[model samples]
Target: MNENEAGERQIDIMVCGAGYVGLATAVAIKQARPSLDVVLADAAPDGVWKKDGRASAIAAAACAMLQRLGVWDELEEGAQPITEMIVTDSRASDPIRPVYLTFSGEVEPGQPFAHMLMNRDLNGALRRRCDELGIEIHQGTPIAGLDRSGACAVATAKDNRRFSARLVIAADGARSRLRDWAGIRTVSWQYGQSGIVCTVAHERPHNGRAEEHFLPAGPFATLPLPGNRSSIVWTERTADAERLVNSDPFLFETELETRFGRHLGAITVESKPRAWPLGLTLARAFVTHRLALAGDAAHGIHPIAGQGLNMGFKDVAALAEVIVEADRLGLDFGQEDVLEDYQRWRRFDTVRMGATTDILNRLFSNDIAPIRLIRDIGLGIVDRMPGLKRDFIAQAAGKGGPMPRLLRGEAI
Candidate 1:
């Protein structure tokens, strides 16, 4: 990076939002094309990332990308592979919730489809890799405004720091200020529900199995973590979710136990329960002029399929590949034409996943007998179809469609 006479920092690319997608994008590009100057600026205060206690399921393809970037080695010790998964649809009060679908096996020999790792661990590993690559991260440096009329997009920070770059990538999350400043509109809606996230320790081992119980409110997922701990994503109506998270400890645990079941033996809450409103936000246009959107800035889907983070990783992989390849060919990587390739590659898959999740959440988050019976029958049919199950596993593993080089475990 260089500074002009006006003291404005100039670079090849400026990535807003230092979360997983932004960090990975910077790392992947710099690792492949070291000549390009890349830097990250986040609105969050320094060290705030260390406080996130939530965990995410990293798909096989995402793991491959992280390994390629040389960050997975640091996270492997704490990662817990999800070897099996079962799905059931029933009311929370049902004494016996019959399993409607089951999924097992790996995408490749000995490689589970996904693994769970705490958000902090993932963020720390990526930040370390960024450090090793000489990438500068400016915490608490929120982009106050963006000017895209000039040859380079100039971002003005809240503190009046100016950053000029040929391309500006917004991974600033669902409610991205940069996205709006760029005049990008979004198609979105709320599900009238909020997801309650927390960690719990169980007396018995999970044996690497994950479970998703579709209750009247929404899907309650128990994702395995290292040892006898598991991360929970329980959805409830907005008011009830707010009450549950702020309720007394005893009351909260009692409500949690009602849906957690006895299969895991007694359970103890290990973290404070937090609630996040569930919604879908898809940007109307992913790229315009010198600016582009990635990760949650591009699309935010329901977490019913556990593919939220994985989708962001896919965006990083695709965007990085497109930028790297364009640069390799001696072309302007920030040109709208070049960025359109990325939009074309990711838009369909993203829309499909969004629609699928929306439909699933709507179909299962109810107790209507007819809808319940139809979905149960569909799940049962899917369970019995080996080929279909394999296809679903492949998709979840992030290996179904034409994969980007990084996702395929190859160098850009």
Candidate 2:
């Protein structure tokens, strides 16, 4: 650590952001090698992340990654497991898959394909764990700018105070000010649609099944929540979404019921509706000199695949492992070579997942007839072919792809 960034406090690493991605990165870094001094900063007061209506479906791989970082135990109770995944084309007359693809075993034996977790609950749990881990979390401090010099990176807060370090991790968010400060350009496009998310309480249990119902306007995904409540991701044209969200609760529930069907019984809105614009954004570069990017800071994708956070978790695991390994070899963890190792491992995969989600969202979340027929037939074909089903199961399990040990459920 440098003595001063022009006469200010110096730490080994100064993290910018305490969102899930930032916190995960901080915990992974600290857990990988506790000897390294690290600090996390965010403008949010005391790591508080307001609940915005929806929770993510954390892939088993992501759970393993958190486990490797020593944080999964804190998340277990709040997570709802997914035992089965049912995909349907609401346009088709016969929409149900002939056989439900069971990835329960493939996703991680005895665990569900993914665990649904409330955002604020998980964030609080992470904050508690960070506290236990001795991480210096500087809440209410936002980075105003940064300066990178020989063998060190320096960050300045809004008050003009600064800190120097051997490394800097920019996990701020999609609209990252840090990335901009680093002069790293990003490529992104508006999705022209918005995803309306909310929790619904119904008489029937969801039976641990996650359903993705493809509608004419978009895909209405009902992911299971604990007990009789289910989470809804209703995507539609931006105009339509705005109208529905502004509509009264009764009208909203009625619209939902008209689309949600009878499988889940009488549904009641449990929370206010929230809308998130769907889009894709990828950083032109994952690293610039001593600074590294992870999570939404590096890439943002459509949520149709439910892999947004999973992708970020992969980034956390990969970068943490690389830096930790370099430290074990008595090398500077923030050197260009080390940063490149992190980039090389993650860049291509990020691009592929980004493109895949974009295409999937465009294809299924529409009323295009030809594409609809192909997608429906493809689902049926995949259903009939057990070998293909196994392949997909393996893929969704987060296996047969490049992965970090942390994502494999092993400590670094």
- Who wins the lDDT comparison? 1
Q: Can you write out model 1's per-residue Cα lDDT over 1-412, one digit (the tens) per residue?
A: 4888778889999999999999999999999999899989873686888999999999999999999999988899999999999999998889999999999948777999999999999999998899999998898878888999988889889899998899999999999998999889999999999999999999999999999999999999999999999999999999999999999999999999999998889999999999999999999999988988999999999999999999999999999999999999998888899899999999999999999999999999999999999999999999999999999999999887989999988999
Query: Across residues 1-412, which tens digit of lDDT does each residue of candidate 2 receive?
Result: 3455368677877778888888888888887789888899873785347644568888878887777666678788878988888777764244343432233434446766688998887677677778888998887878888888666887888877778878999999998988998899988999899999999999988888888777777788888899999899999889889999999988988888877777778999999998878889999999877799999999999888788888888888899899888989988877777789999999998999889888888888777788878887877777788787766765565654878988888888
C-alpha RMSD of each candidate structure in angstroms: 1.0, 2.4
Give Cα distance to truth, residue 120, candidate 1, Å. Answer: 0.4
Question: Which residues of candidate 2, in runs, are more than 4 Å off?
Answer: 1-5, 50-53, 91-109
**Cα error, candidate 1, residue 67 (Å):** 0.7
Q: What's the C-alpha lDDT at position 137 in model 2? A: 85
Off by over 4 Å in 1: none
Estimated TM-score for each candidate: 0.98, 0.94
Give residue 405's error in model 1 in angstroms.
Answer: 0.5
